[model samples]
Target: MAIFTMMNSLAALLLFLISSSSLIAASDSPFILAHKKATLNRLKSGAEKLSVSIDIYNQGSATAYDVSLNDDGWSSDIFSIISGNTSTSWERLDAGALLSHSFELESNVKTVFYSSPAVITFRVPTKAALQEAYSTPLLPLEILSDKPRESTLDLAKRALAKYGSLISVISIVVLFVYLVATPSKSGAAKGSKKKR
Candidate 1:
Protein backbone atom coordinates (compact mmCIF):
# COMPACT_ATOMS: atom_id res chain seq x y z
CA MET A 1 0.00 0.00 0.00
CA ALA A 2 2.82 2.46 0.83
CA ILE A 3 4.61 1.80 -2.48
CA PHE A 4 1.46 2.28 -4.50
CA THR A 5 0.71 5.57 -2.73
CA MET A 6 4.16 6.91 -3.51
CA MET A 7 3.84 5.97 -7.19
CA ASN A 8 0.43 7.63 -7.47
CA SER A 9 1.70 10.85 -5.88
CA LEU A 10 4.59 10.98 -8.31
CA ALA A 11 2.29 10.57 -11.28
CA ALA A 12 0.02 13.37 -10.03
CA LEU A 13 2.97 15.71 -9.59
CA LEU A 14 4.24 15.02 -13.06
CA LEU A 15 0.84 15.75 -14.57
CA PHE A 16 0.63 19.02 -12.68
CA LEU A 17 4.03 20.20 -13.91
CA ILE A 18 3.18 19.42 -17.55
CA SER A 19 -0.15 21.26 -17.37
CA SER A 20 1.47 24.30 -15.80
CA SER A 21 4.27 24.35 -18.36
CA SER A 22 1.83 24.25 -21.31
CA LEU A 23 -0.25 27.03 -19.74
CA ILE A 24 2.85 29.17 -19.42
CA ALA A 25 3.84 28.48 -23.01
CA ALA A 26 0.46 29.60 -24.30
CA SER A 27 0.61 32.79 -22.28
CA ASP A 28 4.03 33.79 -23.62
CA SER A 29 3.40 33.01 -27.31
CA PRO A 30 2.85 35.88 -29.76
CA PHE A 31 0.08 35.96 -32.32
CA ILE A 32 -0.10 38.43 -35.22
CA LEU A 33 -2.50 38.89 -38.13
CA ALA A 34 -2.38 41.07 -41.20
CA HIS A 35 -4.70 44.00 -41.83
CA LYS A 36 -5.86 44.08 -45.47
CA LYS A 37 -6.97 46.97 -47.68
CA ALA A 38 -8.11 47.30 -51.27
CA THR A 39 -5.57 47.80 -54.05
CA LEU A 40 -7.09 50.98 -55.49
CA ASN A 41 -6.79 52.75 -52.19
CA ARG A 42 -3.03 52.23 -52.09
CA LEU A 43 -0.84 55.31 -52.06
CA LYS A 44 0.28 57.00 -55.25
CA SER A 45 3.35 55.74 -57.04
CA GLY A 46 5.71 58.20 -55.41
CA ALA A 47 7.38 59.04 -52.17
CA GLU A 48 4.71 59.04 -49.49
CA LYS A 49 4.74 59.15 -45.74
CA LEU A 50 3.10 56.21 -43.99
CA SER A 51 2.39 55.28 -40.40
CA VAL A 52 2.05 51.67 -39.26
CA SER A 53 0.69 50.50 -35.95
CA ILE A 54 1.07 47.12 -34.30
CA ASP A 55 -0.52 45.77 -31.15
CA ILE A 56 1.35 43.42 -28.83
CA TYR A 57 -0.12 41.82 -25.76
CA ASN A 58 1.68 39.98 -22.99
CA GLN A 59 -0.49 37.25 -21.49
CA GLY A 60 2.29 35.41 -19.68
CA SER A 61 3.61 35.68 -16.14
CA ALA A 62 7.06 36.87 -17.27
CA THR A 63 7.61 40.03 -19.33
CA ALA A 64 9.15 40.06 -22.82
CA TYR A 65 12.32 42.16 -22.86
CA ASP A 66 14.15 43.94 -25.71
CA VAL A 67 11.34 43.78 -28.22
CA SER A 68 12.53 44.60 -31.74
CA LEU A 69 10.88 44.57 -35.14
CA ASN A 70 12.81 43.80 -38.32
CA ASP A 71 11.52 44.93 -41.69
CA ASP A 72 12.78 46.51 -44.86
CA GLY A 73 11.51 50.07 -45.45
CA TRP A 74 8.23 49.32 -43.73
CA SER A 75 9.30 50.38 -40.26
CA SER A 76 8.75 53.96 -39.18
CA ASP A 77 11.64 56.15 -38.18
CA ILE A 78 9.62 57.35 -35.19
CA PHE A 79 7.46 55.16 -33.04
CA SER A 80 4.39 56.03 -30.95
CA ILE A 81 3.32 53.64 -28.25
CA ILE A 82 -0.03 52.91 -26.61
CA SER A 83 -1.29 50.19 -24.32
CA GLY A 84 -4.00 49.51 -21.77
CA ASN A 85 -2.09 50.97 -18.79
CA THR A 86 0.26 53.46 -20.47
CA SER A 87 1.33 55.42 -23.56
CA THR A 88 4.83 56.19 -24.86
CA SER A 89 6.69 57.53 -27.89
CA TRP A 90 9.82 55.74 -28.93
CA GLU A 91 11.70 54.22 -31.84
CA ARG A 92 11.93 51.00 -29.89
CA LEU A 93 10.95 49.65 -26.48
CA ASP A 94 12.08 46.80 -24.29
CA ALA A 95 10.01 43.75 -23.31
CA GLY A 96 6.23 43.96 -22.91
CA ALA A 97 6.06 46.92 -25.29
CA LEU A 98 3.35 47.87 -27.81
CA LEU A 99 4.40 50.40 -30.40
CA SER A 100 3.32 52.23 -33.58
CA HIS A 101 5.73 53.80 -36.02
CA SER A 102 5.57 56.63 -38.58
CA PHE A 103 8.14 57.21 -41.29
CA GLU A 104 8.77 58.74 -44.70
CA LEU A 105 8.87 56.39 -47.71
CA GLU A 106 11.35 56.33 -50.51
CA SER A 107 10.38 56.14 -54.18
CA ASN A 108 11.46 52.53 -54.69
CA VAL A 109 9.61 51.18 -51.70
CA LYS A 110 7.96 48.04 -53.06
CA THR A 111 8.41 45.03 -50.78
CA VAL A 112 6.83 46.39 -47.59
CA PHE A 113 3.87 48.11 -49.30
CA TYR A 114 2.21 45.13 -50.93
CA SER A 115 1.24 41.69 -49.60
CA SER A 116 4.88 41.18 -48.62
CA PRO A 117 5.65 39.44 -45.38
CA ALA A 118 7.18 41.53 -42.60
CA VAL A 119 9.37 39.94 -39.95
CA ILE A 120 9.14 41.09 -36.35
CA THR A 121 11.61 39.61 -33.88
CA PHE A 122 11.45 39.99 -30.12
CA ARG A 123 13.09 38.28 -27.21
CA VAL A 124 12.15 37.29 -23.70
CA PRO A 125 14.56 36.37 -20.95
CA THR A 126 15.94 32.84 -20.95
CA LYS A 127 13.58 31.89 -18.19
CA ALA A 128 10.56 33.32 -19.92
CA ALA A 129 11.74 32.33 -23.37
CA LEU A 130 12.09 28.75 -22.38
CA GLN A 131 8.72 28.75 -20.76
CA GLU A 132 7.16 30.45 -23.83
CA ALA A 133 8.70 31.08 -27.22
CA TYR A 134 9.70 34.71 -27.75
CA SER A 135 9.50 34.78 -31.58
CA THR A 136 6.39 35.64 -33.68
CA PRO A 137 5.76 35.12 -37.40
CA LEU A 138 5.65 37.70 -40.17
CA LEU A 139 2.53 39.85 -40.36
CA PRO A 140 1.48 41.27 -43.75
CA LEU A 141 -0.06 44.70 -44.16
CA GLU A 142 -2.91 45.31 -46.61
CA ILE A 143 -4.16 48.55 -48.04
CA LEU A 144 -7.36 49.87 -46.50
CA SER A 145 -9.06 51.23 -49.62
CA ASP A 146 -9.39 49.95 -53.18
CA LYS A 147 -9.57 53.24 -55.03
CA PRO A 148 -8.70 56.83 -54.12
CA ARG A 149 -10.95 58.72 -56.50
CA GLU A 150 -13.15 61.49 -55.08
CA SER A 151 -15.93 63.67 -56.54
CA THR A 152 -18.00 66.49 -54.99
CA LEU A 153 -21.09 65.79 -57.09
CA ASP A 154 -20.96 62.11 -56.26
CA LEU A 155 -20.90 62.93 -52.57
CA ALA A 156 -23.86 65.31 -52.90
CA LYS A 157 -25.83 62.77 -54.90
CA ARG A 158 -25.11 60.07 -52.37
CA ALA A 159 -26.28 62.31 -49.55
CA LEU A 160 -29.47 63.18 -51.41
CA ALA A 161 -30.16 59.59 -52.28
CA LYS A 162 -29.71 58.44 -48.69
CA TYR A 163 -32.49 60.89 -47.63
CA GLY A 164 -34.37 60.64 -50.94
CA SER A 165 -37.48 58.86 -49.63
CA LEU A 166 -38.09 61.38 -46.87
CA ILE A 167 -37.59 64.29 -49.25
CA SER A 168 -40.05 62.78 -51.75
CA VAL A 169 -42.78 62.40 -49.14
CA ILE A 170 -42.33 65.96 -47.87
CA SER A 171 -42.37 67.34 -51.41
CA ILE A 172 -45.69 65.59 -52.22
CA VAL A 173 -47.29 66.98 -49.07
CA VAL A 174 -46.19 70.53 -49.90
CA LEU A 175 -47.55 70.27 -53.45
CA PHE A 176 -50.93 69.06 -52.22
CA VAL A 177 -51.19 71.92 -49.73
CA TYR A 178 -50.35 74.45 -52.42
CA LEU A 179 -53.08 73.11 -54.69
CA VAL A 180 -55.70 73.19 -51.94
CA ALA A 181 -54.90 76.75 -50.79
CA THR A 182 -54.76 78.26 -54.34
CA PRO A 183 -57.77 80.49 -55.14
CA SER A 184 -59.91 79.49 -58.15
CA LYS A 185 -60.72 82.00 -60.93
CA SER A 186 -64.37 82.35 -59.81
CA GLY A 187 -63.33 83.02 -56.16
CA ALA A 188 -60.86 85.71 -57.27
CA ALA A 189 -63.44 87.51 -59.39
CA LYS A 190 -65.99 87.43 -56.58
CA GLY A 191 -63.44 88.95 -54.15
CA SER A 192 -62.63 91.74 -56.70
CA LYS A 193 -66.37 92.71 -57.08
CA LYS A 194 -66.81 92.72 -53.31
CA LYS A 195 -63.83 95.12 -53.00
CA ARG A 196 -65.23 97.49 -55.64
Candidate 2:
Protein backbone atom coordinates (compact mmCIF):
# COMPACT_ATOMS: atom_id res chain seq x y z
CA MET A 1 0.00 0.00 0.00
CA ALA A 2 2.87 2.39 0.81
CA ILE A 3 4.46 1.77 -2.61
CA PHE A 4 1.15 2.54 -4.32
CA THR A 5 0.78 5.76 -2.34
CA MET A 6 4.32 6.86 -3.34
CA MET A 7 3.53 6.23 -7.02
CA ASN A 8 0.36 8.33 -6.80
CA SER A 9 2.25 11.23 -5.21
CA LEU A 10 4.85 11.17 -7.98
CA ALA A 11 2.13 11.32 -10.63
CA ALA A 12 0.53 14.31 -8.88
CA LEU A 13 3.87 16.14 -8.76
CA LEU A 14 4.50 15.51 -12.45
CA LEU A 15 1.08 16.85 -13.41
CA PHE A 16 1.59 19.95 -11.30
CA LEU A 17 4.97 20.67 -12.84
CA ILE A 18 3.63 20.34 -16.37
CA SER A 19 0.73 22.71 -15.72
CA SER A 20 2.94 25.28 -13.98
CA SER A 21 5.53 25.25 -16.77
CA SER A 22 2.89 25.83 -19.43
CA LEU A 23 1.47 28.76 -17.45
CA ILE A 24 4.90 30.32 -17.04
CA ALA A 25 5.66 30.00 -20.75
CA ALA A 26 2.36 31.61 -21.70
CA SER A 27 2.94 34.60 -19.40
CA ASP A 28 6.56 35.14 -20.43
CA SER A 29 6.02 35.25 -24.20
CA PRO A 30 4.89 38.42 -26.01
CA PHE A 31 4.34 38.80 -29.74
CA ILE A 32 5.56 41.92 -31.56
CA LEU A 33 5.90 43.05 -35.19
CA ALA A 34 8.10 45.80 -36.67
CA HIS A 35 7.34 47.73 -39.83
CA LYS A 36 9.67 50.17 -41.55
CA LYS A 37 9.10 52.75 -44.32
CA ALA A 38 11.82 54.90 -45.85
CA THR A 39 11.77 57.83 -48.26
CA LEU A 40 14.89 59.03 -50.10
CA ASN A 41 15.45 62.60 -51.25
CA ARG A 42 18.49 64.15 -52.89
CA LEU A 43 19.36 67.70 -51.88
CA LYS A 44 20.28 70.49 -54.29
CA SER A 45 23.89 70.09 -53.14
CA GLY A 46 23.93 66.50 -54.50
CA ALA A 47 23.77 64.87 -51.07
CA GLU A 48 21.34 62.00 -50.54
CA LYS A 49 19.05 62.05 -47.52
CA LEU A 50 16.68 59.44 -46.17
CA SER A 51 13.72 59.74 -43.88
CA VAL A 52 12.79 56.53 -42.11
CA SER A 53 9.66 55.87 -40.17
CA ILE A 54 9.23 52.85 -37.92
CA ASP A 55 6.13 51.41 -36.39
CA ILE A 56 6.10 48.66 -33.77
CA TYR A 57 2.96 46.76 -32.98
CA ASN A 58 2.26 44.48 -30.04
CA GLN A 59 -0.11 41.64 -30.94
CA GLY A 60 0.03 39.57 -27.79
CA SER A 61 -2.03 39.95 -24.65
CA ALA A 62 0.95 41.09 -22.53
CA THR A 63 2.82 44.36 -22.36
CA ALA A 64 6.37 44.64 -23.67
CA TYR A 65 9.08 46.07 -21.44
CA ASP A 66 12.27 47.99 -22.33
CA VAL A 67 11.55 48.05 -26.06
CA SER A 68 14.31 49.41 -28.34
CA LEU A 69 15.84 49.18 -31.80
CA ASN A 70 19.20 47.44 -32.13
CA ASP A 71 21.86 49.44 -34.01
CA ASP A 72 24.31 46.65 -34.66
CA GLY A 73 23.93 46.77 -38.44
CA TRP A 74 23.68 50.56 -38.84
CA SER A 75 26.89 52.52 -39.45
CA SER A 76 27.13 56.02 -38.03
CA ASP A 77 29.13 57.27 -41.00
CA ILE A 78 26.50 56.01 -43.41
CA PHE A 79 23.34 56.61 -41.42
CA SER A 80 22.38 58.91 -38.55
CA ILE A 81 19.28 58.97 -36.39
CA ILE A 82 18.23 62.61 -36.56
CA SER A 83 15.06 62.10 -34.55
CA GLY A 84 13.54 59.52 -32.14
CA ASN A 85 15.20 57.50 -29.38
CA THR A 86 16.75 54.08 -29.97
CA SER A 87 17.37 53.36 -26.30
CA THR A 88 15.56 50.91 -24.03
CA SER A 89 14.29 53.60 -21.69
CA TRP A 90 11.84 55.07 -24.19
CA GLU A 91 8.63 53.47 -22.83
CA ARG A 92 6.75 50.23 -22.27
CA LEU A 93 4.39 49.34 -25.08
CA ASP A 94 1.06 47.87 -24.07
CA ALA A 95 -0.78 45.08 -25.82
CA GLY A 96 -2.50 46.19 -29.07
CA ALA A 97 -0.66 49.52 -28.83
CA LEU A 98 1.57 50.92 -31.53
CA LEU A 99 4.80 52.91 -31.15
CA SER A 100 6.11 55.11 -33.96
CA HIS A 101 9.54 56.70 -34.53
CA SER A 102 11.10 58.80 -37.31
CA PHE A 103 14.76 59.24 -38.29
CA GLU A 104 16.57 61.26 -40.97
CA LEU A 105 19.87 59.95 -42.41
CA GLU A 106 22.09 61.96 -44.77
CA SER A 107 24.85 60.44 -46.86
CA ASN A 108 27.57 62.37 -48.69
CA VAL A 109 27.98 59.62 -51.25
CA LYS A 110 25.94 60.44 -54.34
CA THR A 111 24.20 58.13 -56.84
CA VAL A 112 24.24 55.22 -54.42
CA PHE A 113 21.64 52.53 -53.88
CA TYR A 114 21.59 50.48 -50.71
CA SER A 115 19.42 48.47 -48.37
CA SER A 116 19.35 48.48 -44.58
CA PRO A 117 17.58 46.14 -42.24
CA ALA A 118 15.96 47.02 -38.93
CA VAL A 119 15.97 44.86 -35.82
CA ILE A 120 13.90 45.47 -32.72
CA THR A 121 14.39 43.91 -29.28
CA PHE A 122 12.20 43.93 -26.23
CA ARG A 123 11.68 42.12 -22.95
CA VAL A 124 8.85 39.82 -22.00
CA PRO A 125 7.11 40.12 -18.65
CA THR A 126 7.75 37.60 -15.90
CA LYS A 127 7.63 37.24 -12.14
CA ALA A 128 11.37 37.99 -12.18
CA ALA A 129 12.00 38.71 -15.85
CA LEU A 130 15.77 39.44 -15.37
CA GLN A 131 15.96 41.20 -18.80
CA GLU A 132 15.04 38.22 -20.93
CA ALA A 133 14.76 39.64 -24.45
CA TYR A 134 13.21 38.78 -27.82
CA SER A 135 14.09 40.05 -31.29
CA THR A 136 12.31 40.33 -34.64
CA PRO A 137 13.71 39.38 -38.03
CA LEU A 138 15.55 42.00 -40.10
CA LEU A 139 13.02 44.34 -41.72
CA PRO A 140 14.57 45.24 -45.04
CA LEU A 141 14.53 48.84 -46.38
CA GLU A 142 15.47 49.92 -49.90
CA ILE A 143 17.16 53.29 -50.41
CA LEU A 144 17.26 54.90 -53.85
CA SER A 145 18.89 58.19 -54.88
CA ASP A 146 16.55 60.18 -57.08
CA LYS A 147 15.91 63.89 -56.64
CA PRO A 148 14.21 66.13 -59.20
CA ARG A 149 16.49 68.89 -60.44
CA GLU A 150 15.17 72.46 -60.44
CA SER A 151 15.86 74.41 -63.65
CA THR A 152 17.05 78.04 -63.60
CA LEU A 153 13.67 79.22 -64.83
CA ASP A 154 11.91 77.31 -62.07
CA LEU A 155 14.20 78.90 -59.49
CA ALA A 156 13.54 82.36 -60.90
CA LYS A 157 9.80 81.77 -60.88
CA ARG A 158 9.90 80.73 -57.24
CA ALA A 159 11.92 83.80 -56.32
CA LEU A 160 9.54 86.05 -58.17
CA ALA A 161 6.54 84.46 -56.48
CA LYS A 162 8.10 85.01 -53.08
CA TYR A 163 9.19 88.69 -53.58
CA GLY A 164 6.56 89.93 -56.03
CA SER A 165 5.04 92.51 -53.65
CA LEU A 166 8.38 93.93 -52.54
CA ILE A 167 9.56 94.22 -56.14
CA SER A 168 6.34 95.98 -57.11
CA VAL A 169 6.73 98.54 -54.31
CA ILE A 170 10.32 99.32 -55.28
CA SER A 171 9.38 99.64 -58.95
CA ILE A 172 6.57 102.11 -58.12
CA VAL A 173 8.94 104.22 -56.03
CA VAL A 174 11.54 104.37 -58.82
CA LEU A 175 8.95 105.38 -61.44
CA PHE A 176 7.60 108.17 -59.18
CA VAL A 177 11.13 109.54 -58.68
CA TYR A 178 11.78 109.58 -62.45
CA LEU A 179 8.51 111.42 -63.12
CA VAL A 180 9.32 114.10 -60.48
CA ALA A 181 12.88 114.62 -61.78
CA THR A 182 12.01 114.97 -65.53
CA PRO A 183 9.79 117.70 -67.09
CA SER A 184 6.42 116.64 -68.68
CA LYS A 185 6.44 115.73 -72.39
CA SER A 186 4.00 118.57 -73.34
CA GLY A 187 6.06 121.16 -71.40
CA ALA A 188 9.26 120.01 -73.16
CA ALA A 189 7.62 120.39 -76.61
CA LYS A 190 6.28 123.92 -75.83
CA GLY A 191 9.69 125.03 -74.48
CA SER A 192 11.43 123.73 -77.64
CA LYS A 193 8.98 125.62 -79.93
CA LYS A 194 9.46 128.87 -77.93
CA LYS A 195 13.25 128.43 -78.25
CA ARG A 196 12.87 127.97 -82.05
Candidate 3:
Protein backbone atom coordinates (compact mmCIF):
# COMPACT_ATOMS: atom_id res chain seq x y z
CA MET A 1 0.00 0.00 0.00
CA ALA A 2 2.89 2.41 0.78
CA ILE A 3 4.56 1.69 -2.56
CA PHE A 4 1.32 2.46 -4.38
CA THR A 5 1.01 5.72 -2.48
CA MET A 6 4.61 6.66 -3.39
CA MET A 7 3.94 5.92 -7.05
CA ASN A 8 0.89 8.17 -7.04
CA SER A 9 2.93 10.97 -5.45
CA LEU A 10 5.63 10.69 -8.12
CA ALA A 11 3.00 10.78 -10.87
CA ALA A 12 1.46 13.91 -9.43
CA LEU A 13 4.85 15.62 -9.19
CA LEU A 14 5.63 14.79 -12.81
CA LEU A 15 2.31 16.19 -14.00
CA PHE A 16 2.86 19.40 -12.07
CA LEU A 17 6.33 19.88 -13.55
CA ILE A 18 5.10 19.34 -17.09
CA SER A 19 2.24 21.80 -16.64
CA SER A 20 4.55 24.48 -15.26
CA SER A 21 7.03 24.13 -18.14
CA SER A 22 4.26 24.44 -20.71
CA LEU A 23 2.91 27.50 -18.99
CA ILE A 24 6.34 29.14 -19.03
CA ALA A 25 6.78 28.41 -22.72
CA ALA A 26 3.36 29.67 -23.75
CA SER A 27 4.35 33.31 -23.46
CA ASP A 28 4.71 35.23 -26.76
CA SER A 29 8.00 36.77 -27.95
CA PRO A 30 9.13 39.07 -30.71
CA PHE A 31 11.64 38.50 -33.52
CA ILE A 32 13.28 41.16 -35.64
CA LEU A 33 14.92 40.78 -39.04
CA ALA A 34 16.78 43.35 -41.11
CA HIS A 35 17.82 43.12 -44.76
CA LYS A 36 20.35 45.55 -46.23
CA LYS A 37 21.35 46.20 -49.83
CA ALA A 38 23.70 48.74 -51.41
CA THR A 39 23.98 49.75 -55.04
CA LEU A 40 26.55 51.78 -56.98
CA ASN A 41 25.53 54.43 -59.51
CA ARG A 42 27.53 56.71 -61.77
CA LEU A 43 26.51 60.24 -62.64
CA LYS A 44 26.79 61.89 -66.03
CA SER A 45 29.48 64.21 -64.67
CA GLY A 46 31.74 61.21 -64.00
CA ALA A 47 30.84 61.11 -60.32
CA GLU A 48 30.21 57.85 -58.48
CA LYS A 49 27.72 57.36 -55.65
CA LEU A 50 26.21 54.66 -53.45
CA SER A 51 22.66 54.04 -52.36
CA VAL A 52 21.81 51.96 -49.29
CA SER A 53 18.43 50.50 -48.43
CA ILE A 54 17.36 48.48 -45.41
CA ASP A 55 14.18 46.50 -44.82
CA ILE A 56 13.08 45.51 -41.33
CA TYR A 57 10.59 42.75 -40.63
CA ASN A 58 9.00 41.53 -37.43
CA GLN A 59 8.19 37.86 -37.66
CA GLY A 60 7.42 36.79 -34.16
CA SER A 61 4.48 35.90 -31.94
CA ALA A 62 4.34 39.31 -30.25
CA THR A 63 5.07 42.95 -30.90
CA ALA A 64 8.58 44.31 -30.49
CA TYR A 65 9.24 47.53 -28.58
CA ASP A 66 11.95 50.16 -29.01
CA VAL A 67 13.03 48.95 -32.42
CA SER A 68 16.11 50.74 -33.72
CA LEU A 69 18.53 50.54 -36.63
CA ASN A 70 21.99 51.98 -37.16
CA ASP A 71 23.89 51.93 -40.47
CA ASP A 72 26.69 54.37 -39.76
CA GLY A 73 29.51 51.89 -40.09
CA TRP A 74 31.25 53.79 -42.86
CA SER A 75 34.07 56.20 -42.19
CA SER A 76 33.21 59.84 -42.64
CA ASP A 77 36.47 60.60 -44.44
CA ILE A 78 35.70 58.07 -47.13
CA PHE A 79 31.98 58.51 -47.75
CA SER A 80 29.69 61.49 -47.19
CA ILE A 81 25.99 61.26 -46.60
CA ILE A 82 24.03 62.85 -49.45
CA SER A 83 20.54 62.52 -48.01
CA GLY A 84 18.51 60.90 -45.26
CA ASN A 85 19.55 59.99 -41.73
CA THR A 86 21.72 57.01 -40.86
CA SER A 87 19.83 55.90 -37.81
CA THR A 88 16.12 55.48 -37.07
CA SER A 89 13.89 54.13 -34.32
CA TRP A 90 10.29 53.07 -33.88
CA GLU A 91 7.99 52.85 -30.91
CA ARG A 92 6.75 49.39 -31.74
CA LEU A 93 6.75 46.78 -34.49
CA ASP A 94 3.85 44.37 -34.39
CA ALA A 95 4.20 40.78 -35.42
CA GLY A 96 4.57 40.32 -39.17
CA ALA A 97 5.09 44.03 -39.67
CA LEU A 98 7.59 45.47 -42.15
CA LEU A 99 9.57 48.72 -42.31
CA SER A 100 12.00 50.21 -44.79
CA HIS A 101 14.72 52.88 -44.60
CA SER A 102 17.10 54.25 -47.19
CA PHE A 103 20.02 56.70 -47.48
CA GLU A 104 22.40 57.86 -50.18
CA LEU A 105 26.20 58.11 -49.89
CA GLU A 106 28.85 59.49 -52.19
CA SER A 107 32.62 59.12 -52.29
CA ASN A 108 35.32 60.33 -54.65
CA VAL A 109 38.11 58.33 -53.06
CA LYS A 110 38.62 56.14 -56.17
CA THR A 111 39.16 52.97 -54.19
CA VAL A 112 37.51 49.67 -53.48
CA PHE A 113 35.04 50.05 -50.60
CA TYR A 114 34.33 47.10 -48.35
CA SER A 115 30.86 47.41 -46.83
CA SER A 116 29.59 46.32 -43.44
CA PRO A 117 26.31 44.87 -42.25
CA ALA A 118 23.70 47.04 -40.56
CA VAL A 119 22.69 46.46 -36.95
CA ILE A 120 19.18 46.13 -35.51
CA THR A 121 17.92 45.98 -31.95
CA PHE A 122 14.58 45.59 -30.25
CA ARG A 123 12.93 44.61 -26.99
CA VAL A 124 10.80 41.54 -26.44
CA PRO A 125 8.12 40.99 -23.87
CA THR A 126 9.43 37.70 -22.54
CA LYS A 127 13.05 38.78 -22.13
CA ALA A 128 14.79 41.55 -20.19
CA ALA A 129 17.86 41.89 -22.36
CA LEU A 130 17.46 43.67 -25.71
CA GLN A 131 17.72 41.41 -28.79
CA GLU A 132 20.10 42.29 -31.59
CA ALA A 133 20.32 41.22 -35.23
CA TYR A 134 22.60 41.87 -38.19
CA SER A 135 21.49 42.66 -41.69
CA THR A 136 22.64 41.00 -44.95
CA PRO A 137 26.24 41.79 -45.91
CA LEU A 138 27.08 43.37 -49.25
CA LEU A 139 30.02 42.81 -51.59
CA PRO A 140 32.97 45.12 -52.11
CA LEU A 141 32.40 47.94 -54.60
CA GLU A 142 34.69 50.08 -56.72
CA ILE A 143 34.04 53.80 -56.37
CA LEU A 144 34.61 56.60 -58.96
CA SER A 145 35.79 54.24 -61.66
CA ASP A 146 36.59 55.69 -65.06
CA LYS A 147 34.92 52.92 -67.12
CA PRO A 148 32.82 49.83 -66.72
CA ARG A 149 34.48 46.49 -65.97
CA GLU A 150 32.60 44.50 -68.62
CA SER A 151 34.14 43.93 -72.05
CA THR A 152 32.34 44.24 -75.40
CA LEU A 153 31.99 40.45 -75.60
CA ASP A 154 30.33 40.36 -72.20
CA LEU A 155 27.99 43.20 -73.20
CA ALA A 156 27.10 41.32 -76.43
CA LYS A 157 26.29 38.21 -74.42
CA ARG A 158 24.03 40.22 -72.09
CA ALA A 159 22.26 41.82 -75.05
CA LEU A 160 21.72 38.42 -76.62
CA ALA A 161 20.34 37.07 -73.39
CA LYS A 162 17.98 40.03 -73.13
CA TYR A 163 16.79 39.91 -76.82
CA GLY A 164 17.05 36.23 -77.67
CA SER A 165 13.27 35.95 -78.21
CA LEU A 166 13.30 38.79 -80.76
CA ILE A 167 16.04 37.03 -82.72
CA SER A 168 14.01 33.80 -82.77
CA VAL A 169 10.89 35.67 -83.89
CA ILE A 170 12.79 37.28 -86.77
CA SER A 171 14.13 33.91 -87.89
CA ILE A 172 10.63 32.40 -87.82
CA VAL A 173 9.25 35.32 -89.87
CA VAL A 174 12.03 34.89 -92.48
CA LEU A 175 11.35 31.17 -92.75
CA PHE A 176 7.61 31.84 -93.15
CA VAL A 177 8.25 34.38 -95.94
CA TYR A 178 10.52 31.96 -97.78
CA LEU A 179 7.93 29.18 -97.54
CA VAL A 180 5.15 31.42 -98.89
CA ALA A 181 7.06 33.16 -101.73
CA THR A 182 8.95 30.19 -103.22
CA PRO A 183 7.14 28.15 -105.93
CA SER A 184 6.63 24.42 -105.35
CA LYS A 185 8.27 21.80 -107.59
CA SER A 186 4.89 20.81 -109.12
CA GLY A 187 4.07 24.46 -109.84
CA ALA A 188 7.44 24.97 -111.55
CA ALA A 189 6.88 21.87 -113.72
CA LYS A 190 3.37 23.06 -114.76
CA GLY A 191 4.75 26.50 -115.62
CA SER A 192 7.42 24.93 -117.89
CA LYS A 193 4.80 22.80 -119.59
CA LYS A 194 2.63 25.86 -120.22
CA LYS A 195 5.61 27.71 -121.68
CA ARG A 196 6.53 24.82 -124.01
Model 2 lDDT tens row, 1-196: 9999999999999999899757755764556777766677767776667776677877667888877765344566666666654433446888878888766777675434444446666776564543433333333433344447999999999999999999999999999999999999999999999998
lDDT of each: 0.47, 0.68, 0.86
Q: What is the TM-score of each candidate against the true structure?
A: 0.33, 0.48, 0.65
User: lDDT tens digits, residues 1-196, model 3?
Assistant: 9999999999999999889656644657766778888898987766678899999987666888999999878889888899998899999898879999999988877888787889999988778999998898888887886665899999999999999999999999999999999989999999999998
- When sorted by lDDT, best at the front, the candidate numbers are 3, 2, 1
The parts of candidate 1 lying over 4 Å away from their true place are 1-47, 53-55, 73-97, 108-115, 126-149, 152-196
> What tens-digit string does per-residue lDDT give for candidate 1 at 1-196?
9999999999999999899768776674433222212112234654333343345444445554455443343333321222121212233333343454322222224333432333444454454442212223334433332345769999889989999999999999999999899988999999999999
Please give the TM-score that candidate 3 achieves against the real structure.
0.65
Q: How does model 1 score by TM-score? A: 0.33
Kindly report which residue stretches of model 3 are placed more than 4 angstroms away from their true locations once superposed: 1-27, 149-152, 159-196
Score candidate 1 by lDDT.
0.47
In terms of lDDT, the poorest run of 10 residues in model 3 is: 20-29
| Model 2 pairs whose backbones collide | none
Backbone clash total for model 3 is 0
C-alpha lDDT (0 to 100) for residue 157 of candidate 1:
96
